[model samples]
Target: MSDFRDVVILLPGITGSVLANAAGKEVWAPSAGAAWRAITSFGSSITGLELAGDDADDGVSAPRLVADVTLVPGLVKIDGYSRIENYLVEHLGLERGANYFPFPYDWRRDNRVSARRLESQAMAWLKTWRERSGNAEARLVLIGHSMGGLVARYFIECLGGWQATRALLTLGTPHRGSLNAVGFLENGMKKGIGPFGLDLSPLLRSLTSVYQLLPIYPCIGTGAGELQRIAAAAEAGLLTHVDAARAHAARAFHQEIQDAQARNARDEAYARNGPTLVPVVGIEQPTVQSVQVKDGRIELLNSHDGSDFGGDGTVPRVSGTPIEMGDAKREVYAAEMHGALQNADGTLANLRGVLTRDRIDFRKFQRAEDAAMLTLDVDDVVLPGDPVAVRVRASEGNPRISVTLTLVATGEAFDEPLARDPEPGWQQGIFDLEPGIWRVTAHAEGATPVSDLVVVAAP
Candidate 1:
């Protein structure tokens, strides 16, 4: 018999439990005090009837549903709690329990502890489920939201052997930490230190402080501290410091990116790259930038349908997808976000497709061939009149590719084009440009084309 029996585990994001309760859903909201209380009050019920039923195929079987695991910040009342909680409870059939684990609020405060706790909880649950079902081959699926996704990933990486996990799905999790988080942390810290006299509990302070400073950006090590250092240097009129900090963080971020890419390559390197774990899918909202002449005035217009980005308003499309240690695949639904994942309409339908079908839609990665692919490696300082060698690769197709490299110090584009062999391999060209942020564009002869941005240091 196939060891792949369907089983799903739901994990909620930050403040998800409180939101669930305010929504009047059956969620296990455990505060520190409440956990102690539960241990004392329900000591007997702790080992109560093991919730199990017949196999899914059995006519009398009740579909196995377990308690929802919500991440830290317990539960808080927020607007829209009723409608949102009711919808989730009705759809997912969440249960209340007493064994949920809690972690420090600040992700950076102590990642090691947080990661360990999450792994322990997940492993414990898996063990129990496996023992009860007596199925060594049962397929396990994890559904996580926001940071819950990250926790789930850490759990899989730490405790989930290749043979243990079947699939993982994340909604609105910041695999690559979001820039918005930096702002949130900074503001929270300032408030905690100033008005709160830093008297806030360690959990609250950490939630509002420490994790913000570490390099948490998915695959990139550009943490809030690094960004703050850059900002401070820039404010202090230390252009050099700003450049160095930016470069340092970029390199760190690039390392993680490269690592992720390498992992992806390895997964695709062979036919059976381990037990058939498929790609992790994410929903992304559509975004477009446009400028229009309104009443003879050039106006920049940025408009998004409420669901235009894949994230659920908080997480981006890139971060919400599950982290496959192998090949990475993503799907962007034009109008989807965190909450939209369970939509009954086409949104949830797409999710179901990803869950059932092993293939991913590739159109999300498609780019107009006319766009130029630019790659830069600045091993030395970027100074004015520095001899910079830039390499570019452009697709040989209609709307032929044209390249432009600009010096930020002077609003001047190099008078010459970077040598383009239009060959299959790397092509190199030299430019004497001043230090600052450089802009490179690959244009299709007469059409507006795509571009990439790079900052070069002043030598």
Candidate 2:
């Protein structure tokens, strides 16, 4: 067993910098790689993992735990400057200049080479860290953001064995890949631009073709070629094997990636199969149309698509929680962009809880001035005099909350008010009224007011 202390490696997403900077003795900014390079031309005494070198035999071993925090293309970046990063740091007690893992390239390109390169680099780093730390039994905890989550899974399934690594905590990872890739590829073709405006390497094109042929988890590929495939699939209709292959390929890819990681690792320190998959879900506030189930698929209903079945303007709920490996845990939070997972306190708490497996009450760390509305549903219908209950949830400070129920019967109005609770979730209230149309308004004593409309039938 290595004597080295437990290490929490932070892996940054595409175009992401290390967690913090060098100021205030708190390292945030640029990202781990950039930070590492900037601090000194020479490497730090702190154990480091690099994706490009012949540093094997340096005593590195498998089963190394990882924590990925990389950015996804077409999604918001979570950096120290971003509100999401601030929220996560506060909630997770993360230091500004700590050692965290980061991805080597962009995941938006959907290139298997990039994925493979990242996996190889992470594996080497973990092996070396384990050997150097003298803790062969040490576990790896991977926290991936957006597509970085998928990359982490691929790594574990491809290399992690039971003897190495522990768990995987994915924040807004698209295991099945994202439909947005289709759009990106299409737009690129129209502009005569290559993948991200760079030429598509022949190997990359081959990988893309192979991805499409796979029975599961097919690669969306990068650039114009991928766009053509998407169009072909649509033209072939949803019934053809081509379409089936595309769908199955994506699923299979996730399964296979996981299966590969499970097959290669040592079985003692880590689980025999793939690392445990934990999905973090995001929701937007004041939007009753945030979630939807269409064509048997659960999606995040957002304003961008007007279909009540998209995502927080970028990631679809189906893509957000795509992996189906092992017993899984889910956490939901309020935020619009996928990167918001980093800043949403509730989301960060849940992530920390998963990594540490310790019980943490998020309510204790609540901030003052945080407020959200609570809507009640009674038998799938909104009706007056039907025991309508509403509550106010605040982050901090005592806010006088009131609920006013107006009954429009015989041109008469009756108002009833309720108290606000400073906790998360819902509170109940009872109301009985004469038959008529009723409008209910819930206003916090010192905050904004929210109202709902309900109708009651005459007996």
Candidate 3:
């Protein structure tokens, strides 16, 4: 444990931290059984064991305790950023409590609130370390995933976290924002296999964190043309009051980023004195760019081609990879999914390199794209009658690459000139197929062909 050099804090993203009630009951945590109950119990106001801050009327209050959650007995571990914790403890030789800690907060609250709490907790930890270890020179490093990254940034930039922080590293974080939040706001949340799949829409309506994640750029729209402003629809009575609050929060966060960018531009000293900002984002994954809500129906505009506008199933690359300020370094990984970014070998190597100030051999890790890396972006599963969009990209910067999508089950191929959306390398159309396992294969000229198994579930 003493081999650890500096204190490190691991901040989890939305639903990444486990929370318990006053009575020690698991309130919010991962469980296959809990997820099954939530789905089956259709009409209950609250389903499953996720009762985080149930007494709080606003749903943005703090949790009673950041409790430890047990891993499922038999199932293999997958998804979330928890594995990163194990890697740091076991492989990196970091000791829990002594040199490492997990900063778990109520994710539904405003990022500013989380940032404040993080600042307070980190300061306490640093003080204790200085007193006990006699290492007054000891500084702290912050590693945040997804929403946790945003919270850490707020603490460093706004809450004076730079005073004690050595560096700030973010993984798959939406520096700008994510369009998926719009989907949640437009259509109530859909339960997925992971925490993102749990239908938390009813409680999410009052969540400031969700609203803060709305894309800073104009992308989502309604029947009255593209939403010109955040509160445009809500103010016009087209959206509910809950959505109006979300729009208000989204606009506020956008302004905050703009202000931060402007401030950092003028006062060069601000960046010079602050902690080093390192942002590592995932690319080449089909990420939703926009959510069009019309007549109470939602349409997800996903970036199928691995464009800069694309995302890693959650955060768009453009939003995740913001222009760095100060001496901040940015790293991009192709084919790394958002949920698994923290555990990916390439990402972990880059992080270790950054910490040790050593040069990383990129060749050691697998590249999602080769010399002419073919990047394919699409959902892993879709509902019957749902329009499946496919986006393909070549490292040579060719947008018009010859690509073919074949359904293995039915032996159907879509290789002709498909209809394009407003974006490049994007095509969408409905394929009539029975519910079963479907292998979607894409081949690009002069590039390695890639295949992804997609499930076509019954509607």
Candidate 4:
């Protein structure tokens, strides 16, 4: 009789895995020291990591998820994962390798490919765990952050993984896709990564996974503000690298999974046999809702879904839940960022709560369209010790809004009630820092709080 009966597998988003080459040379795994060196010549690295038609020539592959990605207690660490792996062991009381496993895959390939791989690996893993533990309660609980959730949903809905999966909790998964991805396609992948960003357009274009990230909704608008012909994206000047055929097929992949899920929902047998899917969506942070293409340039803009709800900085709140899973008995929202949701306090609490039946009430953290967004006009990298400009915004209707920055190192914090900005319906603040990592949270009256990570490094 094993204490922990479920096989809990954590699937990471794109870039969450460690990719290597044929000679076992790591092509992509941005640890602290490696990142500085990689940034300078990342262009050449992209060549090795690029996808190829022939598997024989495909040099890049993911060996494992970056399990060691963490921020140890002390020495002014950069913005790191919320320590999700530790949470499982300490808070959730689960042993690694016994039940908790991280499913890492080649994120550059199509999600369908990864989903199929999951179906096979998960089956074998589950069988082995069940036989060893001899526990009738043994099952599979999948926790997916970002794009990993898309892969999990595809497996459950389209590849028959639902037969064994008990629950799937998705953190900030973009069910309808993101405009940020559109921007990446318009430009290149690394152009968004950091300061010395390279335009790896050719390499990014070769990845089937990137094409599959195209927005499913009609988010593309013309310079003239015409939003017609949304799904026919290949014609969009911004998506020059992605051919029309690939664009259409990517949309079809999403549709196929959705259609399969609908059929399962309609089937009476599915109710008893299907897995429980819970989407932990983040809201009220800066997120890309739509894009306008002008003269071969893609510009991202944030807009509400007409319901007044916001989204994680990467995925719109409107696309948080798949249509099939929208009607879940409990609908919870958080104020975490897109990348950090896995280790977010609310997310971890919720996961623990779901397991022990003692989850925290996240209703207080709900973000309303009125005051649901906080924006920081800074990239991942900045001049060492530079003061970052922070912008906080709410719907024009918001009566008041405030900003708070908490030093992750010392837990020291300061709150600033922002003054109105020159732009209507916006407030601004300048955050002066002392070489460390900080977490910023925006609070508005009667609205859910919005929080994100900001790193201020020393020279």
lDDT (Cα atoms) of all candidates against the true structure: 0.40, 0.44, 0.66, 0.73
How should the candidates be ordered by TM-score, best one leading?
A: 4, 3, 2, 1
Best candidate according to TM-score: 4
Error of 2 at 278 (Å): 1.4
Task: State model 3's lDDT.
Answer: 0.66
Candidate 4 lDDT at 60 equals 67
Candidate 3 Cα misplacement greater than 4 A, ranges = 37-78, 190-199, 222-227, 236-242, 257-270, 293-296, 304-308, 323-329, 358-459
Greater-TM-score candidate between 3 and 4: 4
Model 2 residue 74 distance off true place after TM-score fit, in angstroms: 11
| lDDT over C-alpha atoms for residue 437 of model 2 | 72
Deviation of model 3 at 434, angstroms? 92
In TM-score terms, candidate 1 sits at 0.41
Scored by lDDT, model 2 comes in at 0.44
Every candidate's CA RMSD: 20.4, 16.4, 22.1, 22.9
Give the least accurate 10-residue stretch of model 1, judged by summed lDDT.
54-63
Per-residue lDDT of model 3, residues 1-459, tens digit only:
355566899887876765554555555555666545434443142333232442453333334322233343222133655567777787667778887888888776677877888888899988887777788877789998888888888787666677688888888888777877766666665455543244566666666777888766666467465453446655665445336755776678657755665665466665576567778878888888765567756677774222236667788877776545323444656568776777788888877767776334443344544345566677788787875656665556554454455667678766643345457644433455567766665655455666677777877
Clashes of 1: 22
TM-score of structure candidate 3: 0.65
Compute each candidate's TM-score over C-alphas.
0.41, 0.45, 0.65, 0.71
| lDDT, candidate 4, 346-383, per-residue tens | 98898887776524444434533333444444345446
